[model samples]
Target: MFNPSQFHETVQRINTKVPDVQHKASQIDIASVKLANEWFIPEPVARLIIWLKDELIKLVEELMNMMTQVMEGIEAPITMWEDAYKWETVRGIATSVAADVNPSSLGSTGQWTGDAATAYTNAIGPQSTAAAQLATIADSTASSLRSCAEAGLAFYIAVALVVAQFIAAEITAAAGDASVVAAPAGLAAGLAAAATAVGVFVGLVAAIGTLIGTEASQVSTLHGLAVDSTAFPSGRWPVATNI
Candidate 1:
């Protein structure tokens, strides 16, 4: 079940983290640029220093790009909060209404007879069915939203790994000649990590799409029921025919 309180708490937690993440990314980007600009290389080592500096700066830029994607993922749940609440509220109302109109709730009209009793029985059945259908719609919508929120959080975690790789590349660049031999290996590791994260994020996005489609189909069914119910004078549905 999607608990609204839990969702709100998660959003609040992410809200507190946004500024810190952005600040760290910005600082790294600026520092990398400064190091690239100020490093002095003698003629003998100029080629190596220039190449390393350019590579470091490039890695820093990619770090910022990864940070951007992570931040977007973090923000997704906050934006979705409204929609989640809407569905949750609908679910609560529908469930309550369904219970109210159910046979057990309405009870038997054993003491009554004629058109009045017949009408009550017929109306209760269809009304209960329609209310149950509405509840199902809400449940489906909530489930889809839950999947999306979970996926977005997972995506952020995955991309953060990619960002860490760039940071490692920057550290290796700053280590100077003693670590120069390790630079290629560090860069390769960073690229490999990025590929893995992007692949996972793509898969998560596709799964979210499928969940949304299912939610839409459930909602469409409820809409159809509402339209069909319009024919009855009582305006209740799945129609009274089942009665």
Candidate 2:
């Protein structure tokens, strides 16, 4: 069985192998801690990973925060939807209800994404279970995607830290392999191999819903709204949901 727990197990396996992973040669001599293709890494790239980890942490933090705001903005259209609904009842449905977005809190940085759009649409589309439950569905869809993005950021940050730590351990154990300049390449190869054996989440996290290819489709109401009212240019379905 392809266990979902493979991700964690592979990370554990990675810590074991990178300083000692399945190498390019293709051997599995784990008894001796040496395999046919197992290899070591170079000093420079290994150090680079450390530096990269530090830098990535800062950048990813900013990304995570920014994305959070964008999802929040996805809900901005709800007010517009409600106001229009009220106007519709009062005016006998004679005027086109308008949608709006306000970025008073997270600055002008928050914007929608393709995933946000798809989520909103899936909830409100005629075929959706949420069409009649727009208020709840809109919030839930934005919240789900926002949460997914946060999870991805956390995953990468953790991966960066783990990668740096494990690779450092590999470097310490490489004292006897100073004669091998091919170690770094081998280390990279080993990481790639482990990543393969692990899963796609090993590299970069895919877009929201991309892991299983389940992004949302457009409905009539969602087709014309702005994807990003603040920064991201995702979808207008959030606005549509309020109505």
Candidate 3:
């Protein structure tokens, strides 16, 4: 389950990582500047440097934008579910109530059947069953909320992985041998390959209930979960014991 507390900690770590990535991007820019001043760089090599630098910075900017949506649409809702709704607490209370009026707790010893005991059992039996049903509902609702949070986290992770792939490609191109002029073409190819893999993986994640997807059905699912709260009204039916 995706605990809101753990997600908060994970988001803090991700926040720290953003600054580190920004710093690395700045260093890349500085290195490119120094190389331009010192070396007899060919046109192709200089263009490659500029292209890779721009692409890296673009990925970082996109990541930041995605983080905003993640916090608003994903983390916020999960936190609300954890704090405001308190489904797990409700489940605990219901479970305890369901178990409290059992034969053992009601002082019904072995073969000790009396009028009072029978009357108590008759009164409590349906209530216990109803409480158990409510407990199950609460547990499932909590699980669903966690699943939504996890789905959003997965999309955010997919974006981060794409950024990492770009960084790796940039570093490789900058540090390679004399055939570095061909780096731009290789990097473009690398970008296409990385996009393909991430696209497929993200598509699967969206299919399994996530916020990232290109298809219509997946997008609809994302909208329903993240945006359309009215579509999923909680506690629609009144609570009542099975009579």
Q: For residues 88-200, write the lDDT of model 3, one tens digit per residue.
A: 89889989988995555666544667976566666676556656666766676666565555665555455455545545544543443224455455445544543454455
- In TM-score terms, candidate 1 sits at 0.60
In order, the Cα lDDT scores of the candidates are 0.55, 0.36, 0.55
Instruction: Write model 2 residue lDDT over 1-243, tens digit each, in one string.
Output: 112244345445534433332231112112113322235544455564333333323333433443344334332233333443453353332111211122222232236448665555443332221222333334434443444434433453444454454334334323222324543444444344333323333343344236323423422233332233321124333334444
What TM-score against the true fold does each predicted structure earn? 0.60, 0.26, 0.52
Model 2 clash tally, residue pairs: 17
Query: Candidate 3: worst 10 consecutive residues by lDDT?
Result: 229-238
- The pairs that clash in candidate 1 are none
Residue 197 miss distance in model 2 (angstroms): 9.5
Model 2, C-alpha of 87: deviation from truth (Å): 21
- Candidate 3, lDDT over the whole model: 0.55
lDDT of 1 at 100: 87
For model 1, residues 1-243, the per-residue Cα lDDT tens digits are 434565555555545544443454344445434443444534434444445445444544544564465556566654555676788899899889889878767656666689878887766766677777777767777766666665555544544444444444344434333344443344344344434544554565566557656655766765664555533235444554444
* Model 2 lDDT on a 0 to 1 scale: 0.36
